[model samples]
Target: MDYQLDKSCVYVQDPGPYSEGILDCENIKVEQNTYFAEVSGDEKYLAVYDAYFRLLRDTNPNLSLVKTNESIHDTISIYSAGFDYTGTSKVTTKRAIQYGKEEQANVTLYCSRQEGRIKIYVNIPLEMRFADLGYRYNGSRISTAYVGGSVKAGLYKCSDGTFQTTDGRLSTSLNAAQVIRDGKTYTASAAYEREGTNDILRVKGFYRNEMFLFCTPADFLAQGDIFRMYELESQSEYLMHNGGDRGSQEDSLTAFRYSEPGVFGACHDGSYIVPVRGPLNRFEALTVRVMYYVPGKEAVYYIYAKYVAAPHEIEALCAIDISDTTTAEEKANTITLQTGQTARLEAPPSDSWQAFSKWEVRSGSDLVKLSSNSGTAVTVTALKAGTAQIQAETSYPYTYEDPLTHAERRNWTTDYKTYTLRITSAESGGSSAAPKKGTTLKKGSISYKVTKAKSAVEFAKAPGTAASVSVPDTVKINGITYKVTSIAANALKGNRKVTKVTIGKNVTSIGKNAFNGCKELSKVTLGTGVKKIAASAFQMCPKLKNITVKSTKLTSVGKNAFKGIHTAAKIKVPAKKLKAYKKLLKGKGQGKKVKIVK
Candidate 1:
């Protein structure tokens, strides 16, 4: 009997009394070389290897061997190779020495095609972890190509230290098509053809995104592959275990499995692949954990790989969002900022799971830099007419529970949010900071009248459905910044949409009935410069439950300043001035019925 084998297909021939030579369906000639030199020692391992490579060649016939090499380590040898350059398609291969090892021998392979397609092969217990990948690309385009391995991965947005589901999870069996996100349709993946019709895989549509792909043997897709995809928008992170317990089921919220780091590599007996698309500058670090188990001979191994992008393809981004109004989604909106003017940038509010830990200016010329940056807010000065990007890094603690085993796990993950700033020239017709005849601040459905008083500007009234208002420290008019000194009587009276207010630091007084009858008002933060609270300033604010005063300059609190306010309303003042504030409040017959805290 005789045998013939090649990269695409394998054939067996009978000599003399047994068989005849055979040609493959693809019309490719076969040679007498073992499919994979690493696992050819044992019939069992060879059979597995042959089957795997056959599937790969069949799935995409463009793959061809490029080169192969070996590395000797004391008692063990590591064999490595790469597929022949076929236009844009390239594959990287790795196999551990299996001569005397009783454990399941395996090979790991990674491949990339020009069209943004990634494929990988992982055999046995080897696993790879990508600590950090992808760079920031927003409001601009950056094209990159990678050759080596294929993988099916999900594109996620970094949110508050956890990865949120931007695009749904992807699978190995999926074809290039559109993916759905947040009820919106988006381009998931596309195929690119090179000059000579070479196919490359690329993620075509979407704004700022990073992908995670796991390469596995074709059989794993049908044999309950350990690689799992999850929609973790509501979760900070997930926990998974590799104990061979396939039927395990548990409430992700109640219990969590053992999770090592960011994400676990697909562990099996084949090739594992990862193809990264989107903004990626350098491979800060790639860690692989190889867990070998052979009954009485269990062992563990690790491998690290570092790769960087070509200088021309590298970019540093400042992740920032800008808005002209005040709302929950303020930081996510895009606004036209006036040249030579300044805009305030803020991170999302804190919650039980995550918070914006800090802000940084990743990259920008003099046209964009941090005027003042802190975790809560930053003041950005638009030096000229151009676009600037800022990044808000958040910290979040990941908690998971495995219901089946009632296992609990905790981890920390850092998240990055990209904010886009479009700086238009002050001469531009759409400048957001250009002085207007009537400087009205519109938020949501309602609009507030910002009128010029004798010495400064004041909020006159709430006329629309706007729900939140942020009084700026100064209003620019003809290039002059005018301080906002007061909230005129009836400023926001009877406005159902008004909910929260951030008084400007330049404010000095709240006239009588200033915010009276604002039934929906619940939270207010008074600036430190406030010197007096006129009579009935906040009277009839039935829903005003909290007042945070950052001022120590309070001179007087007019009678009934907060009378008829919500009974549960709590007054919070600076610790050092708490006693003085309380005394002033009581002396003016304004307190004795409210809660005060330092």
Candidate 2:
């Protein structure tokens, strides 16, 4: 007969003879032709039955077949009859056979004959047997171990030395030779591991601006295996001890371990920790090695992890006498200011991983004082006549989870940019080094006149045909730059073609009728330095509807400065000065129907 069996079926052969004697006493009847027997011994055995007694086939062995007293057996059929009365019962050797956490008090044995061989079924519930072991039944038989959940399309291994998924396009090796972080690339260098230590593999990269290393065990790691990390004095020592190329001379007798405080610690996630002596220099590269040792076997494993540090770039913007029209090269390095004058310095807007830490005076601290330094921008007042070095410090923000407590932690890496500031006494007379002024000049479509002080200029005139006018903070004439300080009376008065006017930061005042009767003017942006506006400065501009004032120093507005403008005009001012500017400009130029907003 041809027979097919699955993993769940067990076949046994007859032992041919009985070694132990069989003694049967109480006949507990469960049915007409069936009986229950409790057998105990310490040897391989076989059970057979006669008319009124059962027999054993083997001598003393650690095998027990006990009949349970529970009624659960009523639902199960444990006997099958394809054999004669002298049938054999075979039990396996000493081993663990329980399924899951449940203990069984009874064993039901079923025997059948096929081709002169006996097949025994344990008669355990199929569901319990498959569920306890990691097997799934596919109707016919238990074919494979059941696995739940899903994995990404990549090469992955299970704990039982089996592959869960294999993708030929990806590398099966766990070695990472290159890593990219924050648009910067880091490459690993060739290095040797410690002598006789070769059970673990290492990969290194960057997390934020710090070196990140990961070490994984190459083989199965037992519970008592030792894992540790150490810091060496220098790269040469790390290379020399770790079986690298050796020179002609003998190895150094002294250990190369530094005994100084360092900016190193274990990252809370329990993978790899970095160890270094003192603070790491800018752009410095470091090597890390993880060691694993088996106590009784005297086997050692080492993993070499290395990473190169890249510095963060910091950009600075100087707003002193510089405007929107200034080129980046002109505002690159140094800042110039007068004594008792304040200038605003700003760092470029921060990205997702970057943040402004603080403003610091690295040198010549007495020359300048930081009045506001909380945010990305700071206001510095030139206090003395000297050059000062101001540094704008920034950092990379990082967050990680703690291994023990599972809490999140935050950290930062430091970076900075320095600028030179030159301050001169305001009372000093004009010097030859100062830009020459006192001459009328034209730049683009706007005209400017140098002030008598030789240090500043004022807006003079513009063509009536020009539809837009922008008063710049500084004008360059004959290679000398002069700050535009004010707008002369009627600078653009009655110019119907001018529809918009932008006042620069250096402009302190607007002269009488400076922009009066410009019928087409609809929008005006006043700079932060304006202090006063003369009468009729912006009056009779019927189309003026949008006005934005950034001047916190504004103190006065002349009569009819904004009269007869658009009835739906909206004047936006700084929030801190909302109430004051509203009362100051009310009924002067801004009508009752106009909306004032902060």
Candidate 3:
């Protein structure tokens, strides 16, 4: 037997498996000049006491030994002895015989003032199995048993004295009670035994972080705040119960035993039935160390079970902005877009932890063109007549640390918003309804196009009714005045309501089919500025009529311009211009049926 000290601990080695058993079970006392090993019948068990006796037994010949009446503050049996060696300074000491049941024994020689602290020399019997000071459990957390961080959960064969693999991917077959519900014990797994042997540690509960660790206790009935038992499967590696499984599967420790110092895996692995909410994060950390005792070799092996807790809760939130000449009501309301028109959409401002991720055309993709699916802002073009809805989404990263600097940062949340768009065709609004530029308006029985600059106004389509009409010289719009230019094509076609017509003074010329099919027309008046007339401008006007031309500069007239007019209609002209009017009318095939009268 031998004894040594390092830091605060004392290590003792007892080399023996003798033919005979020694060390009496009954308690024994100590005295001066009397050795503990000589009386105990085995020197190995009392070697540390003998060494202490040799050093101080002679120095304190006058020292007297007294037995203590107080019981040892431990579960193991013990015999306590006190000694007083007061030469120059006050010296006091205590000797203890810590008795272990079949497998272990200890002898301690303690000093009251050694290196300004109490110290002890420990002696123990060592055979085949390994041992330590034993486990210390508490509600706050558990301290690791091994001095080094190496092994986690793995398998070992006692018969062959060999170890299988120390890998993060591990599986176990065991049947054990894992949860405590309403103060009653519950089994967490349907199957909890390997080869009909309970190979798992039945835990009171288990706790874990999203990707950090899975933790429980070494004892079968140890209690925790999360689950009854957690059997870590190789694939998911999450806690399991009879009901279901919970928590994330990602982890940093890929192997049970790593070449690197800190990497570790769970001790046992298997499929688990966990809760939907998964393991609860306590926002703290704890340690659990599992021990395997080999009785044949009298050896004990241990590894660390480290885990981290997650924060209590988390939430994501999103909004959209449109750009154009829209009123507040229009902006809030559904957007109305003409086919072939495009609109701009903007996202809300981005915050440090919150930012826009992308845009999506949730519906009506065929009617609109999204500039791109991903951006803080995008442009949508109306492609066809249809309705489309758009959505904006956000992103929140899981990691809290900055990627570049590795500094801690605030956690993030996400949100989303949506908008609707309506596209319309030109036919629904009438001719020039969807003009890219210019203003189209419906007034009375006609629709007209006024240029952006208000330079001129032209009839865009045939009038809706044929009532007697008169074109104005100028039209006022938005504080701007525009000249009434040439009449648009088919402006007055197929109208029976008109009995008389008068052209505005600013009107330059008549368009084709401008007055076609005006069967009720009886009289016509032209402005002095009229220069040319288009084909079929007055064709099919069957009413007998009097045609008056105020413009002496009329240069050309189109074919059938006056067809179906009264056969004996009188073409009125200014005085002394009868001969010139006759020539202009002759070209329109009105030379024989009409007479120029001034």
Candidate 4:
């Protein structure tokens, strides 16, 4: 019944059976599900809705229709959908869960109003499935529908297609229960998903930035204060539920809002679920995105408070400036601030630290901050006095002494993965910007490099750990990378107390768990246009010890390949594969401790 209408906007062309991807089901609880897509005869037909499920046959080779003038607002279906070529596809977006392959997905929803901030972009096209749902269910710990846990529960799949049982029949014939949950109608945080498929991280069309905190209703909610909901997932950190928060994702098209002091909401639509306190029960179900707590405006800066000036000499530059504002409109962003006399020690003693290089402003508020143990160029001085657009972040002073012996147990350190870039004050004029850098940080300008394997992760603006920068041009101290060439694969795979890894000399290949969980990695090196080493790639590198395979183009070495190694750390093979590295070091028992070296 392909129909089309422009004025009131009504266009439909076969919108069902689309979602052939996504399933982190974050442990699954099996309540409601929605990767999205579908609409037929439900009666309310004014028209103008489109969403399909299943994509990737080379996606968009002129499939066209990636339009984004946006204006749909919300829709949910995915009670279940699957085709599995191996599986993987959840991470619906807010940026985190990523692993693809289940197939078909068209999720088309839109809303517009650029420049002021509501610029949402969700175009699902998948690939890359690491799959690791397993956690346990039925037996309990909850996470069914399937994640490997209790071998996947309830067996989702609905929307009337069929599948959802306590008696059982659909738990993982790929799972069903496509979308159907009210359990009585959960709002803010009912704390569902003892395991899998409860609300596949639901929330259809929402926005948020709410703020308020007498603390505990799971600690209020701070930041620009926004929380809208159709879906939100996070089992615990504090707690999170979904379905209604009414402040949708933001950038303001239908409405815009943000209250101060105790903070409130209304950035646009609705949907929020923030909370992740104390590993929640050992990462309970895991699905967090609440970035920065808005208690007062999150102004923490104390990376060693001042102990950062030892050998601290700053001077690194890169600039570009413009004003009178308006070319196509939307060109104003520069950060670097410092200027004051504020002190709080217990962690800033390299005599407080000092360094410089870079600042180009005019977005307004003249991006201020010039001192307090060397203002260290922050947020490009809230720009407004015109003339900014500078770039001089070649500053240096990287000291380390937290060898991560359990990393204080767990205040923070999954070997690190924090990234924030909320620099406000956008060259003033018609945008009025300024007052960000803490909406949970992360917006642009990030380039990293770390060779002899890798390390260029970002987001450590105010400390609490998360900084391993240096590699844009490559000079990775000890573990090598003097000239550099490759090592992207998760570069450094979480430096869990990095244990010796060096691989430079015009490198060639190492990506994919480039080092995966270091756990005091045990020395690694494989120069010479390397080749293939993927899969668990080095698994959790438990005291890796030694493995200098110098690939002249090696071939194959994946799968628990070197589980919990450390046969005195020395297995450098390459003498023409030395009988396939002496039968893979006697099937990893360590064949005569393999060693060919030259």
Candidate 5:
């Protein structure tokens, strides 16, 4: 029978004398006397048919099928034709074809209507070309293009000859875009494009539905037509599992030395590993860009990973004490210090696991100066009359197992204590509640006048016969102790027998002519509280040569306070106040030959 097949329809021609007519190929069974013929078209198509030519299922309209009664056979010849390719290229298939031509290939199969329908898949060999490569992560399309620029491959053939998508899962040769774990799937979340290299694609997201971050170059080709698989992990996990493995170690070292800052190494499967370095003492968040080299492309690509480390727990105790006066209880929270006085702060661990870390001045830094911030103890010198807050920190290492994952994790805990420092001027005797000026009273040979009633005293007079007059800082009179604050005018003036004089710490000034005309006086020691020397306080003391002034608060020196003193005399002052003292004593003191030393 001579019949022309339409391009859009399939024609069945049965060889049986009684069955010489067109039949629906979908319902027909592969009986003992049927043969199939398919026509080629410019566009490719797929179709399925029953064992006989009775049931015809047209899947695509671009191709046509014709069954001719050319031979009598129990097997049906399924034809998939019209594959466009270059003539020089070769085509091969796993199943041998009963007949082959330049433009078509066919495979023979045996089936019947009782055995169910038969599916013929057209396997066409096409050139592999990557127009644009990108990925999908965390159920989101991170890149602009799907594998090979949207090749339309969501359908996969099952072993039963039926096409399915495996429950909506994407089926493609580029499996790097999707990750399946614990019965769930995750796709790439984001994409980063390197400048000037649009061909190189990078994607990042959680790997295997875990918190571990995964990033890598998305340009690669699998070995075969089947889907390619890859294993991804974090740098810490890689190190912990393969630290001693020779090949892995070599790769790690090479990557560590040559790769960019945070890049670890490329895994054997081509995915790059990043690190989550932890055991941190404080909360930290950071993003790191990793650079990797592609040997085949001779180019570099970049990927980014983010890390967040949580802080752990530590205990510390620190105390600040006025090194000389404050008691232990008073030192715990607050202490008072006079200008120029020092306090020792000690930070000891509350537990054996803790140790001291550092010390810092949280506020009022100008009020105090520290010897050193590190170590268990630091000496702080009161700089001025102000309040300061000093802080000390301590830390210890801690390890615990994660409850859910049962993984041992390590971290650090830190604790700090801040102590308040109340600083007062040394001239004020480091007290705010000092007594007010009151009536004068006699205490032994030296008469005392209350500068601050009951709390302070001044030297009113001294015995002229006393060779070495020592001014006490405080003297008890009528059962009350007081700070000796000053030397009254003419208190010991013209005392020839007084060859040496020592000023008390609380003394703020020397009255005018306090020791004038004392020819025998040679050496004098001034206290730290001394602020002023009245006019002619030590005038005409010809023998006065050794002078030690310890007061850094000196503000005034009266005219001729040291005039006519020994020409070879040397005046020593606080090192830091030397220049000011020199300028202050320029025209008021000993001869120009007198050397002022610190």
Candidate 6:
């Protein structure tokens, strides 16, 4: 027989006769499915070594033929990866042997297809653990041709341990992305890149994430052909053995894992491991180590809740929640914020706050920060300018100081919260409400008195409706040359109706819940003086995308202020001000890659 093989495909030539034993070999048997390499990160996913295994399979028919004898297990060892790289799309691992100050590996872990779980290949479990894994270098060649514009990945210190990565492209071979040590975060502009003859990439050999743990299996490569194991990490693996009784009903189908940790379950091979879903349990320890590096500083921010809670846990956010002022009490109490207190505004709820460090509130001249750990009350006394608004924002990879004092930094969310104070002076007993001038509201303390009216408030009854009752076709309040500060609070509370809002320049702030559930209203442009924004200020405004905050000196923005607002991904932040915007966006609940413009 003759044959030919190449990179893409293979071909065979003419062949002769075969041996007689070829057909008779059907009676031979093999042990249970072989062990394979396992990999788990982001979530504790499974890395089953389905290729390499040492097995003795020679079945004998003892009078009555019977199938028996089988066993398999995962290697004991977990890698700790605290360096959180944002642009990281894959993690690769290979085994190495030191020879003349150089470590070499004959095998590379690669990605394989399994029905449900991720599969990786390794050189049969010689030593399995995070420690066995080290750096491999092959000079850098522009990888952007394959990876989309040099996906920059920064190193993050684990939340509680030390995992260091040199930032940038270092090592003269590749740029370093990140590193962690002694529970502190560090980064360098250098690292190494591993190269291969054919550009074949592989996944890591030994690893564990918040979700799974994977190690290379013995049968990773059988006869040099790759064999994949799908559905490696499934709940069925943890199913209880019914004393040799019933088996699973659905054998082929796999279960989708819940992206979470701490939930205990069993394994088919009868084993249990805690899941780490977010950051790698990254680990590295060194004593009496000489080092030369600089410590970096992180931008500080505050995170907060932006919406109100429905009876149950459900997202109730639309436009600024101000229009929903059905009850003067909630309307009045809504925008009214107390300094030095963390307002438990609803909507995004605990998850929003959970992502960042503790947040602080600044009273008068509204602006909050995460660095202010002291209980010192926010100083907002000077805000007698144009109504003052207070809001806080926070961000994630929530860092823990103790337990080795490490951190897992990743920009997933920019939490925001705001307390609005609209001060344009409303005429008291005039069927309208505005901030109390010269003095704050103290119950019975009259607001603006009905002095003069340029137009009429009897024109439009609701939005989308042509004004049947005409006020001054252009209602100017307090002699201010501008449109009426359309009282749109709690406007369309539970109603998914209401579309289009004509904002008046003189209007300073939009009350909470104003257009909370208005799934229709899309365009919004607040007048220039609009200061502080309230939480849930725009929660479920699905179609409401266009938002213009003209406040030049605008200090703070509320949490979830613009969440779920249709095109948040297409957000237009002033380009010249993105740095300051990014600084302000450090709070949790913010998304990455959001488009910004000048």
- What would the per-residue lDDT of candidate 1 be over residues 350-438, giving only the tens digit for each residue? 56445546787665555676755666667677677766667777676767897788799877767665565666666754434543323
TM-score of 5: 0.28
Error of 3 at 21 (Å): 99
Per-residue CA lDDT of model 4 for 290-386, tens digit only, reads: 2223232221000000012221111100011111112111111222221221111111123223433333222232433323322333432222223
Considering every candidate listed, which one attains the maximal lDDT? 5
lDDT of 6 at 54: 10
Full-model lDDT for every candidate: 0.42, 0.47, 0.43, 0.29, 0.48, 0.28
Global lDDT of model 2 = 0.47
C-alpha lDDT of residue 119 in model 2:
28
TM-score of each: 0.26, 0.28, 0.28, 0.20, 0.28, 0.23
Range of the 10 consecutive residues with the lowest summed lDDT in candidate 2: 314-323
Write model 2 residue lDDT over 1-598, tens digit each, in one string: 1112233322211111011112111111133123232222222222442110121112112123442221113333233211111113332222112322233322233433333332233332211110111111111222212111111123334464222223321121122233333334454321112211122222322332233222222233342222211212222222233423331121211112211111122221222233322233122222221122233332222222222332331110000110122222223435555677665666544574457558888899888999755567677788987778888776668788989998999877666666666666666631324432333444444556666444687897887787888988888643457789999888898898988899999999999899999999999999999998888998999999999999999987877889888999999999999999988898886667999899
lDDT digits (tens) for residues 1-598 of candidate 3: 1111222232212111010112221111133322222123233444333344433333234333432222444432233344343233322233343233222112333322222222222232221111111111111112213222223444443354333225422222222212222233233331111111112222322321111222222122221111111112211222222112233231222212211011112212222221111233221222223333332122122222322321221100000011122322222324545666666665544654546468888899888998988777677787878778888777664447789999988766666656677667644542222322234433333445553344677755544355678877776533345677777668878888888888878777788889898888989998887877877899888784788888876776777788888888887888766787677778674537577788
Question: Positional deviation of 465 in candidate 3, in angstroms?
Answer: 3.3
Query: By lDDT, highest first, what's the ranking?
Result: 5, 2, 3, 1, 4, 6
Tell me the deviation in Å of residue 260 in model 5: 98
Off by over 4 Å in 1: 1-455, 477-479, 587-593
Clashes of 5: 24
Candidate 6: misplaced stretches above 4 Å?
1-495, 567-569, 573-576, 585-593
Backbone clash total, candidate 3: 34
Between candidates 5 and 6, the one scoring higher on TM-score is 5
